[model samples]
Target: MTAEKALLGCMMKENHLIGDTIIKAGHLADPRHQALFKQMRDRHQQGGTIDLVTLSTTVDLEPFGGISYLHDLQSFANVEKFAEYEELVLEKWKEREKRNILTVAKEEDWEIQKVIHALDQINEAKIDDHIAISTGLADLYEAPWQEENQIKGISTGMLRLDQMTNGFQDGELTVVAARPSMGKTDVMLHFAKQAGWNGDLPIIFSLEMPNKSLIQRLVASTGAINRLKLRNPYQHLTEAQKEQWPELIGRVSETNIQIFDGAGQTVAQMRAKVRKLMHEYPDKKPLVLIDYLTLIRPEHHYGGNAHMQVTEISKQLKGMAKEMNCPVLLLAQLNRAVEQRQNKRPMMSDIRESGSVEQDADVMIFLYRDAYYDQDADPKHLELIISKNRNGPIGTVFANYNQFTGGIRDAHD
Candidate 1:
C-alpha cells in the first residue's frame, strides 16, 4: 500500500477498532464491504447518513472520499457519548442478526464460534470490488476528469426518449413531464413495453395507472390501435382494427417489465422494491419509471416543509441512479402555471414548488402537443423539448403519436 493508504488504514483501525468511537469516518478498505456502506456514503461521503451496524460489517479500514477523518474515536464509555451507548448496543444486536449465524452453522455442520470467524471474514475482511476498493474512492470521483463516460450502447426500448438522450446516463436524475390527457400515461406504457420487452431489466414503480390499464395500453400500443377504440366501438369497427389485438398480445407477453401497482407507496417502499430488483438483475442496471411525481409520498417519519420533502425525495432518486448506475425515468407533473402561460412550453423555474426538480435532474424533457389546444393541428406532432442537459445539445425532437393506437414513433424531418 502507498504511504497515504497506510496512514488512513491505521487511523481507521485505531479510531474505530480497539477503541469505542461513538462517531468515526473513513471507508472500509475492502471493496466487498462498500455496498454495505452505500446509504451512509450517499448523503455525505465524509460523514452523515451513516449506519453503525452497516459500517461495522466491514473491516475497520479508513473511509475514503470527501473530507473524511476520525474525529470522535473514544470508547462509548466516554462521558461525552454515554447516551449513544444504548444506540450502539441496539445496532450491535442487529449486526449479529445479519450474520445469519444460526443458519450458517447448521448448513456447514460447523461450530458457532467457527461460523462467527467465517462470518467476520466474509463481511469485513473480504473485498467487494477488491481492485476498485484498493484504489482511493477519490479516484472514483476524480470527475471523469481524466476520462469520458463511454456508454456501452443504446437500450433496446420502444420509447425514443432514450434515443433522444442516448439512454439515461449514470448519476443523473432525469424527469419526464407532461400534462393530463397529453398521452403521458400512454407514452409510459409504450416506454415500459419497449424497455421491458427488449432488454432484461426491471421496469420499477408504476405510480400513475393501474397495472391492468398499463398492460392494456402496452398491448394496444404494440397493436397499432386505440385501446378504447378497440374495447368499445360506437357502431362497427374496421376488420383491420379487430385483428390487431392477437398480434399485439403475442408480441408483448415475452418482455420482463416488472410493475409495483399496490396502492400509493411511500418513498421507503419504493426503495425496498428497487433494492430487490437490483439484487435480482445484478448484471443489468436498474431502471425506475415512476408514472407521476406528485403521487409519491415520503415515509410518514419524514418531516419539514412539503416542498422540502419532495426535494429530499428528488435527491434520493438521484442517489439511487448513481448507486445503481442505471437509467431512472421518473415521470413528473408540470405546475398548473404551464397552463397559465400563453406559450404552454415548460421552463425549469416552473416545475412546481420543488426547485430541486430542476437542480437534481441530469436530463429534463417536457412532452407537449399542439393538438390539445387545437384539434385542427396538422402533422399530429409530439414535441420533446430538452429543457436541461448535462451532455448533448438542447432542442426539440418531434414524434408522431397515434392516439388511436397508443403508439409513439419517431417523426422523419
Candidate 2:
C-alpha cells in the first residue's frame, strides 16, 4: 500500500518520472492509487500540470477521503528512492496477477496453455536485465571446482552416452534422428525407460505409435521378454514367461512416465499437455519426448509447405524447452537420401523437412545400425553419434542393441 502511494506521489510530483518509471495502471494495487495515476498519466500526456489541484478537479477523490488522502500520498513520496518504490509496486502487481491467473485457470473455460502463457507474460518483467560482468566472474571461476555445477543435468541412464554428453541438460532441445527401421524408436524408448526408472519423470508424445504398442515394447524391454511374444502375451508367451507377467507389470507401473499417443498433434497441443502435467505434478522434473518430429501436424497451416511447418514446430519446441525449463528429447528422421549413400550414417544435413531442426537442437544424436542395410552385418552393433552438442564434446558412443528384447548395452558391457 505504501509503495503504491509512493509510486502515485512520484507520478504527481514530477510528471516526467512517469515515462522513466514505466509504471502502468495495473502496477498500482490500490484502486485509489490506480485512479490517481490514471488521471496523472492523462494530464501529462495532454501537456497539463499533474499537480494536486488539477488531479482533484479531474478525478473523483471523494471515495478516497477527499483531498487529504492525496496529501498523505504526497507526504510518502521520496524522489531519491522512487525506483525502489516502483519496483515494489510492480512486484506486488505481479503477485496479484499470478493469483488472478490461477483463479481463472480453475474455471473450465480456460485452456491450460493460455493460463501458462498468461503467467509467463506477467512474470516477464525481469529485474536483472542489465548486470555487471564482474558479478558473474566469480561463479564462472568456481564452476569448474563445484561438482554439482559441473554437470547440471539429469542422467539418460546410458553410461558411455552420459559420460560423453553429460546427460540431457535442462533448457536444451535434443534431436535423435535415424533412417527408417534403424532402431530409433527402440533406442529412444530405452533412454526414456532409463530416465523413468531413475525417478526422472518422462513425458512421451508418441505421434507415430499407439500407447499399447509402446507399452508392449516397454514390457518386452524391461522384462527381457521377446517383443513378438509380449505382443501376443496370453498365447505366445511360454509358461515361464507367463509367470514373469506380474514383475513386468510391476516394473512398468513403478516408472515415473506418461505417454500421450496423439497422432498429428500440433505444437500448441503438446505444450498444453506438458503444462497440464507440470501443473498436476508440480514436484517432479519433466523430460518431454516427441517421437519423430515430422509426424507432428502444425496447428496453423503454412501454405501446404511441409518444410515451413516443421521449421516452425522445431523452433517452438526449442523455445518451449527453455520456457518450461525442461529437456526436450525430440525424435526425427533422416532424409531418404541417407539410404542412397553407400554409408548409411546420417549427417546433420539429413534432418528431414528443415535445417532448422539441426540448428535448433542443442544436441543432435543420430542412431545408426549397419545391419539395417547390410543383411550380414553384426545385428547387435549400434552407434549413437552425438553430431552436435552445444554444451559438450561431439562424439559417438558404440553400444549393443538387441532387436528382439529391445535392450541396449554399452559396447564395453
Q: Over 4 Å off in model 1, which ranges?
A: 1-149, 153-164, 230-244, 300-304
lDDT of 1 at 190: 61
Off by over 4 Å in 2: 1-148
Q: Write the per-residue lDDT of candidate 1 for residues 1-413, one digit (tens) a residue.
A: 12223323332333331122122222233342233234333433444323333345443535432223222221112432222332343344335544566676787799755754454343222223345564777667776677777674325242455555776666667787877777777666666666666565647576657787777677777876557764564444467755764665678876677888866675545655665565567666556778767677753223345675576568667766765566777887777888888998777766665647888888888888998887788636888888888776688877888877778887765
Per-candidate local distance difference test: 0.59, 0.80
Candidate 2 global TM-score: 0.68
Would you give me the overall lDDT of model 1? 0.59
Find the number of clashing residue pairs for candidate 2: 0
lDDT of 2 by residue, 9-101 (tens): 866787777644546776777777767667777777788888789878877889777899889888988876676686687668878888888
Best model per lDDT = 2
